[model samples]
Structures are given as C-alpha cells and as structure tokens.
Target: MNKRVGNQTVRLESKPRIISTATIVGPKEGEGPLRDYFDTILQDDLNGEDSYEKAEKSLLYSVITAAIKKANLKEQDINYLFSGDLLNQIISSNYAARDVDIPFIGLYGACSTMAESLGLASMIVDGGFANHAVASTSSHFSSAERQFRAPLEMGSQRPPCAQWTVTGSGAAVVGTEGNFPYVTYVTNGKVKDYGIKDANNMGAAMAPAAVDTIKQHFMDTGRTPDDYDLIATGDLGKIGRKITAELIKDYGYNMDNIYIDCGEEIYDAEKQGVNAGGSGCGCSAVVACGYIYKNLLSGNIKKALLISTGALMSPTASYQGESIPGIAHAVAIEFGGDKNE
Candidate 1:
C-alpha cells in the first residue's frame, strides 16, 4: 500500500530519502560587497599568481570535501556527482572532483545549476539508477565579475535590484533509501524572458520566468495554489516575487498565504541593504541546503516547493543585444509519515 503526505507520495515498497547539505564561504562573516569569500580568494595573492581557474578550483575543492565530511559520507559510497559552476568548461567542478575518488558528471544551467542538479538527482533515484547521489554548484564574485564584466575595483554602482554573486559553494547528498526526506515531484521550466535592458535589475528580468513555472506546475499537476503549504521561488527577490504574484493572479491563481521567495528569506532585507533579494546559483543552493532542509527534518514545515529561477544570459550575450533568457525548475520536498515513525 502507498500513502500520500502533503505533496509527497510514497509507495509501500519505496524507500524514503534525505538530502544532507553543507556550505563553505571564501570570505569571513560581516563583510560588505566583494569582501566575502568569493572576493577574498579571487583577489588575494595567497596562491601567488593563481589564475581565475585556479582560485575556483581551490575554493570548490575545499567546500565539496568539507560538505562530504559534514554529511558523514565516504567518497566511495557516493554513486555519482552532479556539479556545475559559472566558469568556462566548469573548471572549478572538474578540478575539484579530480581529488575525490568518485565518478563525476558535469552539468551546466547557468544560475539554475542547483535546480537542474536536484531535478536530475531526483530522477536518478526515482528511476533506480543509483541509490545515492550528490549535487553541488559554486560561484565567486571576483572571478565571475572579471570574466563577465569589468575588474573588481571598477567602482560600478549597481541598480537597486542587482544581486551580488554569492562567493560560496554548497553541496547536498541524496539517498534513495533512508529515513531522509524525499523529493516527491519536479516540474522542469521552459525558457522565458522579458525585454529588460539592464542586467542590474535581475528580479524584473526573471519575474516572467518565475510566473510561468509556477503557473505551469499548477496546470500540469492538476494542483491548485492552495494545495501547497508554501510556494517558494529559488532566488526571485522582492521585486520579482511581487511581479510573480501579480502575474499568477492574472492567470487566475491566488497564492497569498503560500508564497515566499528564497532570496528574501535568506537575509534581512534591511540589514543586508538589499532592496529586492539575493541572486546567483549559490543563493538557492545554500538556503535549501542550510535552512529549508533543516526545517523539513525538524518537522517545522511539512510541504514546500523549491522553484529555482535563473537568468541564462552572459555579458557577451547581452552586449550583442540579445534578450535575456530565464528558466525556473521546481522540486517538491515533504516530510512526515510511517517512515518517520
């Protein structure tokens, strides 16, 4: 016999699973823009002429290993590793994985790395290919900025909604059989874009993507907005969340009590001085791995959807006058049942 709990459906013979997550910072705590882990590692001459690729390699290597340790999993026990980053050819992930003795598969979805990883990881377990897997992504502001835009010290004043690329790495371990929480459902997002000119206001640019995914999830699953206890978007900050709500309502969906944005929840809006919210691959990854996973395990929140939204445009693409492309992928995670007992 099978039973359903909130959004999670478990088969009688099926096993419950959980994702253990961890994060590593380049910069110490209480630092301003470019003062955090990403910038410190990138700008510091500690490596003595280390290239951008080298800096990324060093940072990701430490973080992934630390995350594995925190999860208390051995390298051989991990079936596969799915990782991505904003570097060319995913050098950071590749180089880092080399030190570990696990099989590796690289993935790229721009800022949607975490969602892409979770979606794929869920499929691996649900399809019975592998019982255990790990998903990770990383970004460093100094390296990303230098590669995408100008040098770090350019003193460029960003727009109100611009998000700082998190200088951190996060990882999660998922098992098909355990007392761990299971990923119940996932909806892959299609690329959507609004003609927003400036890259600074990412929330406005990504608003349409978030709205489309949320609407599509409801339609495809025959689920209503009220069906979910909490509808959380990955990194859509204040502006994007508001826009997303309005657009969903326009499409005849009301999500008043259930809607929240991960970006806004990660940090204090007033203290962080972020008018809108956080953005970047790490934004969703860290919050999910750190906060959401903890709460779910502790039974604080029963059912939730993690919709990670990404703006899939590079500086070159934007400079060539290309319209920004966006994507949002949703993964439903839930807790509570006989398995917990």
Candidate 2:
C-alpha cells in the first residue's frame, strides 16, 4: 500500500513497537544531569579497554546486547541490526556487529544515526520484511576528537559555540507487537548546507536542516506543535536551538512551548564546563532511549517527535574547506495505543 504520506514522510500502518532499549554512557555523561536516566554508566572513560576507540566499541556492544536481553530475545531472533557511530568506517558499530552475529546494516548520518537506524528498522518491521530488528548508535568524545579534531592531550581551545561530543551508546529493539512505545511515522531529511564552515559550530550548521525536516514532518502529518507532548531535536545546543526557533516561527509554527534540545537538556552546561552542551550520535540516542522512553512508559508523555540531526562532514571535507552539510530524521513515537483505537 501507499505508506508514503508526503514527499519525505512515511505513515506506517503497522506501527512497529519499541520493545526494549538499553543505554550506556561514559564518566562525563554519567556525571551529567541525565545520569540517573541511563541504564548503565561506566565510571571510567576507557571502560577497562586499552584504547578509547575500543572502549567505544565496548559501549556499543553493551547497549546492543543489553537491549536484546531486555526484550527476552536472542541475537539470532533479531532479523536485522542497523547501527552506526562517529568513527572512520564506523569501526565501532562494525566490531559490535561482529560480536552480535546478526545481519547488519551499517549507516552513517553523522550524529543523526540513531533516528536513521530507527526509521529504517520501523519500515522493515512494518513492511513484513522482518518481525524484529535492532537499531543502535554510539559516539565517544575521545574517539571523535581524534577523528575530527586534535588529540585530547593537544588541549585544543574549544570555542563557546563548540559542543562536547557525548560518550555513550543507545539501542532499541523494534518488533511487530509489544506494549511499549510504538513508532508510527518517520520523516527522512535532506542534506542542507547554509554556507557555514566552522566545524566547531555544528549547531549553527545543522539547525537549518533540523528546521526543514521538522516543518516537513508537521506539514505531511497535518499536525502542529500542540499535537505532541514533546518535540525533541538531537544536539542543536543553544545557538542552533535559537536559530531553529526563529526559522520555525517564520514558517508559522510556534515551538517555544514544546521544543527541547537533547544537547541543552543533557547537562548542566555551566557546571559541566562543556562549552556548548553535547553533540554526537549518542547525545540524542541515550536521551531518547533512556529519559524519553521511560517518561512515555510512565504515561508522562503520550506522543513525542524525536528529530535527530547530523552534520555530515568528514575530516577530509572540513580539511578541504568544505561547508558542513546537515541532515535530520524525524520519528514519531506513541505509547499504549490499540491498533483500532
């Protein structure tokens, strides 16, 4: 049938359910305001590994395995695994997949990977192509820094607008039937670059992409900000959040009441000493899976729209003086809904 609702949105008739979720964070994130919401917290950034990169892989492995276990499903029971990370070749997710023994689909949407994987998994399960699927994403501050910037010891001067890359991983299992939160729709974003070239200022670069996707989501669904209990966007710290608000207002949608940026809410920015809060694949992943998922389960929220935005720029692109292109994917999740009702 015509699952396509609008130009970029898909209205899933099957409503794939998020059966279970697991989130793991490093020491910094564990010390943040949302510390209590996470499923697992590693006291050490290295997580008992010899290298930070390996530790990131460990985080991904822990979350994926824990999500499968929480759902009472074995690795073999999952028909597909969609995962990604902020690493060259996505080595973190690649190695994690090696340990899980599931058919894997590696994706790269920069930091928007969590929503990207979730959207794909929802479609697969809703289309009868799979009964169960796992969607996961991870990011590490040390690994990202080494990949995209300088080494930790280099003591690079971070600008006020620069965001801290979150050290964490989150995974969720999407199945045909469950009593948990259900994914009802998805909106895949388009790459948009607004001539911004500062790698540190990711929020500014990605804000427009987020606004475009959110506007498309509302237009396609014929919904407004009031329709959902919350509208959360991936990173977008303070600067990006402001820009998004202004742009959305220009589009005739007032988001002042319901909007929350995961990066801004994840930490006590002043106390944490993080210049511009957090930004990474794990930033939105952990917040959505840990904090938002629990709130939905407790009936605190009936409907939520999570827009995970990514800066699709590689070290090579940045080095070449190319402007950062941004993308965002939106997923609508609802809890405790009957199929007919």
- What is the alpha-carbon lDDT for the whole of candidate 2? 0.93
Local distance difference test, each candidate:
0.70, 0.93
| Worst window of 10 by summed lDDT in candidate 1 | 32-41
RMSD of 1: 4.9
- After TM-score superposition, what is the CA distance of residue 42 in candidate 2 from its true location, in Å? 0.7
What does candidate 2's lDDT look like per residue over 251-297, in tens digits? 89998988999999888899998888899999999999998999889
Q: Model 1, 26-60: lDDT tens per residue?
A: 44212433222121233352233367557656766
Worst 10 residues of 2 by lDDT: 332-341
Most TM-score-accurate candidate = 2
